[model samples]
Target chain A: MAGMNMISAAQRFHAYANPARFMALSARLLMPLAALTALLTGAGLWFALAASPPDYQQGETVRIMYVHVPSAWLAMMGYGVMAVASAVALIFRHPLADVCAKSAAPIGAAFTFLALLTGSLWGAPMWGTWWEWGDARLVSMLVLFFLYLGYMALWATIEEPVRAARAAAVLALVGSINLPVIRYSVVWWNTLHQPASVFRMDGPTIAPSMLLPLGLMGAGFTLLFVTLLLVRMRAEILRRRVRNLRLAQAGGAGEV
Target chain B: MTRAFFALLARDLRLAVRLGGGGGMAVFFFLVVISLLPFGIGPDRELLAKVAPGMLWVALLLAALLTLDRLFQADYEDGSLDLLTMGLLPLELIVVAKALGHWLTTGLPLVVAAPLLGLMLNLPGEAYPPLILAMLAGTPALSFLGAIGAALTVGVRRGGLLASLLVMPFYVPVLIFGVGAADAATGGFAGEAGRQSLLLLGAVALASLVLGPLGGAAALRANLR
Candidate 1:
């Protein structure tokens, strides 16, 4: 009960509602977060490559899992962030939420592409085929990549910022429903892909030795996502500020 | 609402027909695309027949998309969209009417011309009925959903390409089901495939019937601002 209360209570943490406050908070956290991300990533990569043993059957190619798994996780996490930010923007009209969602898109898209690329590389070595449409997970992820591209394209193509944000919000909401569909499509349909092992009712099938590096990489990649999101958000805010300043200067000149 | 709906539909149809090369442009574009495909893939009757249903459906989709922009573009530009919005009639009815106009000009003509092109590709003669049936069930959904994209991009200058980008992803399920139904008919599984695809298409169309107008109205309002 206490845990449930705590979780519910944390949901009200709208501290970043104000853009200036959010920027200040993000600026202060950026350097420390960047350092932590680098350190974790370095350690994670070393552990993934050297410390972890190769799979009994798959051998050295199992190393691809380090990059592929984390990136896949981050892809979903990025969409989660966007969806939550959009909800906040829609319900509370938080200005920062819109910026957060917009900035997160390109970063998410890059992560999704990375996941797909690494998955393909990994698949080629193990499955003996470069592409497999029968794999529901693979196909769903491809669809997701397209959806991300479409959402970002919609944002880029629109001239008005607020209108673009609103439209993108709708797209984000619509696309988020697909995430679950993608996750389950493999299991529900008898596809070529293997079923979930790491996440299931039966706890993880991975041994602790491999699990350690995998967990480390997962954490490292999540931290890296935060760092990139902050950097992009700062850039977006600065860009908007410059535009506002230019508009204001023009307005003053008109008054003169 | 019924009276206003028919009024708006009639007005849009008249304007679309009266516009220089309006309906003809979409038909010509469709014909040109169909004609070019045979040139690209050297004329092989067997291969053409095999791929005919998909080819005709894709061409029809592209041609239908080509004219969807005009559904609200003229009204949006001339401020008639605002007039419609401010009138006593609901925007949903107006959206349905506009979609009907879009279909009358774009989809109906494509359906009429599809049989001739299908014959050129040597599609089995029996496939024509289901092809037309699928389009009859499917194209309304395209018009309804495409209206949302058109309304979303109403005021933008280079909105045509963006409209296609925004609308094409939504069109995938329609394309899948429409072509799947036709393919099933060719493969002699028409009873199951045709029913399922048409049913799914109808469900999508019905969903859009409610959501499309709301989305279109919101987009139009956003553009006005």
Candidate 2:
């Protein structure tokens, strides 16, 4: 189902990719996406704060899951977005794929920073320590954060647009291995962090009370990411257009 | 095809020895880093002995990382990389050859020198063989993985620092298992944990052997284009 959704999404990306058409479609998308994000965020907050019962063991502190878990999930998902777009850029030579990959990097890095910050926040009361060196998941996630910074640095250092895109595309593809490592670190080591309860094989172990709010928050975060992504991609396109125009003007001036 | 690969390998090996300051500088850098640890961390013999394995692996990583940009940047500047790319041998194979040359020059010397330096830290007598074994198995991975970053930033000016930043994250797992294997010998070399660490370290090196060439080749092509 995920694979199917990705293929269709990629098709939509390839279909109306003429920049003028994309701008029109994305402008239409912005308001609806923002509205949906707001709606989900409000409902999710209400349920998480008021409706969801506090854990008998964890008390009110478990509520941090509303922010922490979703941030972690979306952080990984953002990397997936970058990797997939990088592949499209490399293989299909889709005009917008590099833009998409470039746009996803800072947003993904922000989410990763959020995940680490919230995880540290959650850990303070839960584990009695702000950080745990013993935990593989935390360590791997830290590595992922650094990887994101490095990927962005690569793009920044390479001046030529085409060269930067291809070099960064390759780096993104290589760093994609981090996704699986972070996902499985909890399962493989099972250190201080709790094992994955929601995405398990025997069905979600959590009761209906908390899962509902978690799902809502997760949906809200995904929508927010897509919204932010569209805004950033539009900005990148405009930036490139401005650069090209300046170059053109300078060339004409030199000729005159 | 095989002849071309070996020729490239031989040429690189020669360059490393004759033109690129040889592998002597990396070993000397390794010694300096190891020597500075006592001053930096304070002269606590017990602590130095305890943390020697991890410290040694770290020094090895830094030394190898420092030399990585030289792998392709020289050929790139001299326009020889273009020749290799145009030759009959695939770029992936060329990457593999250069990576091997890198390992032979840099990684091998460090592995040989690691034991002598361990003695400076009052390292456990039992740890020597395991430390050598671990480095022997793991250091090639550092070279191979470093090739990817070297290739990525090949055409960029003064890209050594950037390549190091990019390659450091990829070096984590290798460092973990290498230090694990080297340190575990304290509990007796026969411990199951040491064996597992060495095995995993080897597995990582093998995986990098495959992935390194492929990624490095792709990055090289991108830069060359």
The residue-by-residue lDDT of candidate 1 on A95-165, one tens digit each, is: 78889999888888898988877876777665444443334555456667666776776777576788989
Give candidate 2's fnat, 2 decimals: 0.00
Q: Which sections of candidate 1 miss by over 4 Å?
A: A1-17, A182-204, B1-225
Per-residue lDDT for B77-193 in model 2, tens only? 999889889999999999999999999999999999898678656677888888899999999999999999999999898899999999999999999999889778887345888
Count of steric clashes across candidates, in order: 0, 0
Q: Please give, for residues A39-72, the per-residue lDDT of candidate 2 as tens digits.
A: 9989999999999899776678778878878888
lDDT of 1: 0.77
| Model 1 chain B: lowest-lDDT 10 consecutive positions | B35-44
Worst 10 residues of 2 chain B by lDDT: B36-45
Query: Model 1, range B83-153, lDDT digits (tens) per residue?
Result: 89887787767877888788888878878888866855667766888788888888887888898999899
Q: Which candidate ranks first by lDDT, i.e. highest?
A: 2
Listed for each candidate, the true contacts retained, as a fraction, are 0.00, 0.00
